[model samples]
Target: MKSMRAMNVSQPRRIRIANGQGFWGDSVDAPVRLVEEGPLDYLTLDYLAEVTMSILQKQKRRDPARGYATDFVQLIDRILPSLRTKGIKVVANAGGVNPSACRQALVEVAEEHQARGLKIGTVTGDDILDRLEELIASGVGFENMDDGRPITDVLDRIVSANVYIDSFAIAEALARGADIVISGRTTDPGLVLSPLIAEYGWKQDQWSLLAAGTVGGHVVECGAQCTGGNFSRWWEVDGWDRLGYPVLEFAENGEFIVTKHDGTGGLVSVDTVSEQLLYEMGNPKAYLTPDCVVDFTSIQLAQDGKDRVRVSGIRGGEATGTFKVSIAYLEGYKATGQLTVSGPDAVAKAKVCADALWGRLERAGFTYEKTITELVGLDSCHGQIPGPPPDVHEVVLRVGVKDGDRAKVDRFGKELAPLVTSGPPGITGFAGGRPKATEVLGYWPSLIPKDRIVTHVDVEEVQ
Candidate 1:
């Protein structure tokens, strides 16, 4: 048994982590390809973002089990046979707003693959919404990190409040006979890190070791971000459509080989890995998490071969008591439209374009918290951001405003479509049936004590 699992008895072995899904709407083919393509000990998918929590919360309110990523359950049913055949485990934050419900859904999927039963695990307790009042009364001010105001200032408008938990809980679930681990609002890197811990049985205080694993997780958590999907030099990348999903071939000693599936597309150049290293990273020297503070610079990525990069040499530090806070508020609805100006004086034509649209709206009694009009293809970007004004070929007259009045927003939406038929000749990219009015959900930030919440792990049979 030990010989078959060389990683278990010795100096540790490479454990591969494949990030199949980048965000909620990413391709299902990604994960399917990853599993069929190579040997992966753990498969990871991260589906939650700050604003995503609000969206999921709204769905949960409508139906108890409906909020979690339904696609994940569907994906499970498709991949369960492949998973058992390959002996590959999966970890994901697709539980979104409801971990227990997602767990239940996975068990149903497992039951369908009756040849081999599957044990699904869920990690809860990050949510702190119900404890808001008691936490505030205890002199713990969960103030808005941005505005510094107390929680009461926007008490009624709050939607979802969850802490970014460490990956150790995920590791624990895997240790406790769980074939799959589902969670809500875990750190993006946690999905990857937990698998490393589960495979190696790393203790909690293995700070330097855990930090190294965390760095690897960050690299692959966004699917193709490190795999050349979002690279700025898209031209430089060889094959994007077949671009390989990322994999972290982890080792028990906190080192790993960073590579993609063999014979798959995508390049693992040093520059590509470097770009992913910088995403959502605050302090490279101290990339803080509930697990440990990761020192990204100490890490090194060496090109081992084609589609393979060796990742090693990371350091770690202590973690802070507080976790990152995510809060949201109501931003109301906004409507925006753009028109191209392409006459002799395109800039002048652009301003004329703006005036004509707003002139009528103003006459119709339209006022909002803000109104903006800009010319694209010319001076849209960096427009009075730091300074202003660059004269060029054509300007796109972009106008937008937000207000409590839904009618005003509806009117603005109606105004954009007419501009295409009546305004400039070069307008495009608007294939959708007209830009409909949509309400934008705002975000808020605050903190809660670690003890204020508790995480529960539950398992059940599928009906």
Candidate 2:
């Protein structure tokens, strides 16, 4: 930890940070637009989801150098020249389960772009899948945070286990002159929070500043969410075609303004920012992070201007000694098949089709551990409410099955197409072939002692 005396710079230096991506499949053009459309000091991207690690782990098993987000490499190829010209830094968690592989890909992209003197930092050590047995022997239980089950129960089926690391390693990478930082399994807020820690030289004990930065990170972490993409009042928001991603104007006093680029789309009011604040939040009083536990209830929001909201009055407490661990395992196999049922009695015909499919499967001695049948137009979203089936022109009959036996699930797929010919009238939409059984991955959340995890940062310069 570097002391404030070593910083030796003027106080109250503000920076502009914008988030271009919210998740793995976010718009590919948003990141490039964020860089080219406006002035930005830092660009943060997030690419991992809870089940993303398992998917990436499977990819790495097939190919040694293929686990990270490939989109990030291509995005960098498009934006490297602008980033270098603008003197802008980038921080992202596109590393997935393979930071080294991601680093290599980024190096290749940089070389292809002919970008020189760029320091790419690779942050590692969040992965603990190989150390599970050793940690268990050393008295780490890895108990399920939800059901309190021991991890030994599913040890053989476990595919990925990563701890949610903090932002300090990223800050260290920046301090070491890294122009871009790549990390694995970092908390989404840490992507933005790390740059604040690095640029402001905030100490670990500054809970208020850390909490403020964490809130700032959370607001823009989802990209357009704070800028009215998923706001409850969608009708109130304008410019859906060109919605601007969220940007933060962070200051040294632990206050930041959330806004979008002038003349760009998307609305950034208190309501939109408030809606994003509660997204996936558990406890308002103690929003836990690796750096500190924030008091979200103590925070205040006000409209600073059009498409701008000011956030202030945040308080925080000390961080817990344990870090949350995301563990994914192979649950079983699942397959789904759907058919569009139309005409006089679409709902009734769909129901009959579902019943016939199940009866045929039972007669063939193909029983599954679980099965679901839904009439897409009727009750797929909010499971069948108390009401007569709405009279509709057409309804899609979707059926799925999950079981430990792959053969059974595959056989279940074979049953759906037969329904179109034999079950009910006016059944179509089977153009897409039978659904093949796919691996079903389950998530297990756990906790690990913070001391058990040690993160490393390596900064390499492009020649």
Candidate 3:
């Protein structure tokens, strides 16, 4: 458990890190476009979130070889030639709950494309699903971070639990000559930070440098966000059809310029970069990660050129002794159904339809833990902030219910179709059959001692 700074070594003068994929379901062509359009030292992709782990677990339960993000393999197949020619390495957390399977799939794709010399690395030990019970038995309280509830509250229904690891293991894989690194549940910034560590031999104790690298990663982690893809001033952005992905021109001293490939469409200015810096931000002074505690307030941004922003002045502190764990468990069942009501007094009719449906369900002894009724064309999003509802031509009536009892939620689904013929005169748009009850997975955020978890890296050549 040496400090990251303690293992540091010297590296090149500069490195270019580009991020193509933001989340699990981002644009599939973005990764290929990133490799084809530019020169980069590394391409990072982030593909996991809290709810994503549950979905992947269910997929793995149904089929052994299906849990990881299959899109990564398809993208690799499309970009293998460019990757070899450009010598651009890939670092991604597309492993979801199964890094080994993800690495094997990548290896298979490389071999299929005759990319014989490609080396793939797998980082495991983030998953703690099978170890939850053992840890709890060993006096690991595993209490919920928000509610302080113990792990035993939903132990029987838990599906997946993974620790948010850092960049060390990923760096280790790259140090062993891995061309691609597949990891399970590493912190989003770690995917980008690990390359800095692997290439520059950055020591673990170099808090300020690690912090600056993390700030760079956070800015571009969402791919095009800092490049004006999700900017508030959308009209200022050019080329709506092909927004450019992000590229970080990182220096050995931890100063980097955030930009995109040449001739690409997107605005990379101080405003755009500042907007992404506030995304998912908690305390500006103490943005915690497994590698270091980065102080967002210390960051400085400036427009370097037409589509580049220079990011500097980042400061960081030593790392904490614990790791945040994301755990998901079965909460209940939920179903939602919607009907469009048209013509004059549509709002009134929609409200009437919703009441009728709920009345029928309640009369039949079906009580839901939670219920919601929304007028889609009106106050669904703004609520009372929109003020008095306007006289609209049509409003979609959406009703949803959630409960631990599956049968109750299912019964609520069946009650929606009857409203078309029996309850409302202007009701229509119910062609998709009855709304099916789906399992509602609840998220449990917790923390665990760093010593309790162990992470390792394995590298294999495509044969």
Candidate 4:
């Protein structure tokens, strides 16, 4: 408890940032607990994923005010009093696929107490959908990085093409009286960087200083993953229920102190921090971003006593000449069907059943690039003991495939139900409905020259 008490105090004007939640549906209790349990200057909530963008895009197509994160508004309603009372600010990308509606919803929540009229701010003008043609005319071809295809191939087919905007736009929103700042596609590090820029007034191109703070933001962006979620020495982390959420004590000299909530569910040991340090990181030195190229190799983490690791000695230089674009498109159709194979030659029968299904599909003039069949009692995610268990009560065989032909794919879904009554015994169909024929969205990550795109910062008052 002594170590816990040490983290619960104030640092006097130092910006303390606590990431209350990692993604949507992580833990509703976690954010409320972070607010009530600790003294936080700013709370950053990240609720986004590749699939989330697709979901939100669908919502936007239906209603203009329905695309944003409404759950954030409801959660904010519960915490408005606490935030207003403690003078705590908030920055979150729960705007998911829409930032404007998010800001408006927050203003409505603030009207309950009339808390200075709740000056909500939105940072937009980053979206480039309307200007893609102009960008191409200017010789900016956003070639598909994965398939080497040009942007023209799927130009109209593209649903969402957003550049990961930097923190300056968000920081500008904060500087101009935003109680809560909501954004659409700002980078994860930008969430943390915006708070510091707003609080400390750092210049845009102060590369060294900006790089250092960006490093701090990147370190703690993934919630407990940075603290101890995937530590190498998993058994060593104690008291996971109270494992701490990351804390950033910002300094004006381009440095910050990284700690956590006093009594949270994780640990921040050097090993835990290190494990997160390498997760999906490409280059140690010259790590690229929209703002600066940070050098992770230059970072130094000292166990500045229990539960606190002080990081310093980071260096950085010029950013890359281009911005990476995240584009999603229709890939193909995928179907997964599961059934049990048991009785005598259960395993062999399961294989035969799979082959028969494929054979029938082929005879029906349907084809796919790949077909996968796995016996659940044998695969790792579901397998146990590795041997036949008792009487082999059931051996579930899961089958899946991906194909470009939609008609053929639809035919495959119709085949699953028949197998229950026709082929192998005990072939219980989990659900009665046919498998879906939804479009498969694939990520197309590529870069465009920085000179071609102009990122602007705009802030507007709520109605």
Candidate 5:
């Protein structure tokens, strides 16, 4: 197979990019099915989330070889033969907090499958955990974008800090002949857009084209979301048992068609695509990304077929000189405990059980920064907005508390088990043991100048 650089430079009329996995825990079979089911130019998988990076950091701290998403390695092994035979290159941000470790694992997998001559490229330098002190000393405030609080307040408790990188390094890897590109902390859309940029040779200053690619990426970033998995009118969707992930047939001019495999179940319509476009979106007029500032409001969507949607007319502005940073720090500790309350008047009994638990905590001179009590089967989701709760057969009593004192949170966990035996006649479901206090990691969003960071791309053959 020729490298992406040696591919036809005239640009194909359309390129199909498929998203196999959405988040870290998405179905492992999705990628395998994506490669085996139909035609694809690139298979992009997104595995990193703000909390996921922190979890990976904790794993790396415990075992140096275990930080990256291990599922990605397993998935690659499952699809290695198909990927090689079909000449389908892969781009993924499954490295989480450690791209080097992820690349090493892929090398081992390639060798295991006897898939010689496989080039794995890794993009690193997004992680800035060790440089936080130096950056702060250099006047990078690292303030919380939402609250405007300096990171110095929680510097001592920081576990992981990674800047959201763009697609330039990923494109560089593909151009350098990497069959699989692994990136740490790259933006989700960048995983999809990188392949487009590499194949089309889109210039760095192509704001509108970059924005159009970003829009296309955002539509399919969540895997099956744009394919009717989370659609509002889910009843209209077909083949619920075997829903297919999304595929983007992107044109050189930035127009794209959203669809799924030919025989797959799932609906791809204007409504489904629009829902995904509006998801996690802020300021519809100015959607900021590392490569460009996309205007989601200007996008045009149309239902072109039974399960196909065409998206076009996306406009964008020049990108800012800054990159968003995701930082996680230990705020304190929290523990939650739940008990199933059955029999008549279940809701009333559950409320009493919650009050008793907190009362016991207060009696023991324990106070938490926050406390939450909810009836799981009743008003948990809508809170008080749904009016008075309906009378149900049973409800789960859930009590959660967060505090700086771990001992207090631990004490709260002990309160729930006792309630199972002593509080109410119908209380049960405490077989899971006491809910242990866990470190409460808080998210800190900020931005740093793009010039302050440097991304490195390296490709090596698994010979």
Candidate 6:
């Protein structure tokens, strides 16, 4: 196979890339369907969430070979043959806390299919849990970005720490002839942007082009979200069950169109695409990434026919000298329990049930660091919206507690089952059994100088 770097300098008029996953728990069949349903040059999968590193770390602690997203491996197992046969490549951040383990799994999958001559790349050096103390000793404070607290406050409690790497590393993997690039803690947009960089031979100083790719990536990063899954106007969308994942038809000049396969479900219009563009958006004028800083205000969107939106005129600036770091630590323990309240005055009955549950816990010497009681249907969210709430037939009484004490959280769980028989009539819906206390992981976002972190890319061919 020809190396990605060795491809002709004269690029194609257009290339098609699609993202079939938004996060780790998104539909399992989406990526497989994306490969089989339509033509694509590259398929990207995003499996890491903000707190996903901690979860994968816990798994790694339990089993050495089990830190990556297993779902991705399964998906690859199902679609590897199609990907190779159709001349499609894959780029994904499903490596979680361990890209090496993920690459090993993929190699095994390739071997299982007796598939040879396939190159798999693993991007590493993002994880910094082991280097936290060393970095702190070297004057890297690792202060909490939100509150400006020093790392010494919870230094020992840190579980996972990873810096967000850039698309350049992924592009390098492709340049080395990697058919599939699995990365650790890559920025969501990097997955889509890397392909454009590799295909178009985009230069590092090309801020405008980089920004354009980043904006395009942000639009389709969440799979079908931009394709009408989370649109504001739900009544206009159709084919919910088979909604098409988003596709980016890219030009060498940094222009692109957001669309999906024909005959597939979902809508990809200006509104749907616009909704996704605003997702997780901070400042409309400046969106930061490892490669460049994008000006969202400069972006132009045009309706380019049915199920297609042309995106252009994106402007960007230089990236910061620092990289954002995601750290997770042991926060405490928390457990939540809910019960249904029916019949007349259901809202009143639900509120009463919440109070009773907390009162019982308080009386039992089970004080917590914090506690919350919510009449779910009434005001769990938005907290009692202005004006009178209409009468409801039923409401769910949900209560949760968080504390440093595990025993206290465990005892809180015991108090919920008693509510079914002891407090308020019409209490039910505990068929899944008692709620158990689970460890709460707290997020700590910080920044590290770009010079302090080094990314390594290793590509190995399947034997």
What are the root-mean-square deviations of the candidates from the true structure over C-alphas? 3.4, 4.1, 5.1, 4.0, 3.4, 3.5
Candidate 2 clashing pairs, residues 3+ apart or interchain: none
lDDT of 4: 0.76
Report the Cα lDDT for residue 361, model 6: 76
Instruction: Specify the poorest-scoring 10-residue window by lDDT in model 5.
Output: 1-10
Give the Cα error of residue 297 in candidate 2, in Å: 0.8
TM-score of each: 0.90, 0.96, 0.95, 0.88, 0.96, 0.96
lDDT of 6: 0.90
- For residues 43-85, could you state the per-residue lDDT of candidate 5 as single tens digits? 9999988989999999999999888999999899899999999
Q: Which pairs clash in the backbone of model 4?
A: 240-265, 242-264, 242-265, 243-264, 243-265, 243-266, 244-266
Of 5 and 6, the candidate ahead on lDDT is 5
Q: Give the TM-score of candidate 3.
A: 0.95
Better of 1 and 5 by TM-score: 5
TM match of model 1 to true structure: 0.90
Error of 3 at 210 (Å): 1.2
Global lDDT scores for all candidate models: 0.79, 0.92, 0.90, 0.76, 0.91, 0.90
lDDT of 5 at 396: 90
Screening candidate 5 with a backbone cut-off below 3 angstroms (N, C-alpha, C), the clashing residue pairs are: none
lDDT of model 1, residue 32 = 89
Q: Model 5: how far is 274 from its true place, Å?
A: 0.8
Tens digits of per-residue lDDT for model 4, 145-258 = 878988878776777777777788889888987878888877888788888888888787787777887887787778888777778777878878767778877777766677
CA deviation > 4 Å runs, candidate 5: 1-12, 386-388
Which candidate has the top score in lDDT?
Answer: 2
lDDT of 3 by residue, 1-463 (tens): 3564454444435699999999989989888888988888999999998899999999988988878998998899899899999999999998988778888788888888998878999999999998987999998998999999988899999989999998899999999999999998999988889999998899999999999989988998888999888899999999867889999999988999999999888889999999999999999999999999999989988888789899989999999999999999999999998999997789888988988988888898888899999999888998867466576899999999999999888888999999899876878999789998999999999999999999988998887
lDDT of 3 at 13: 57
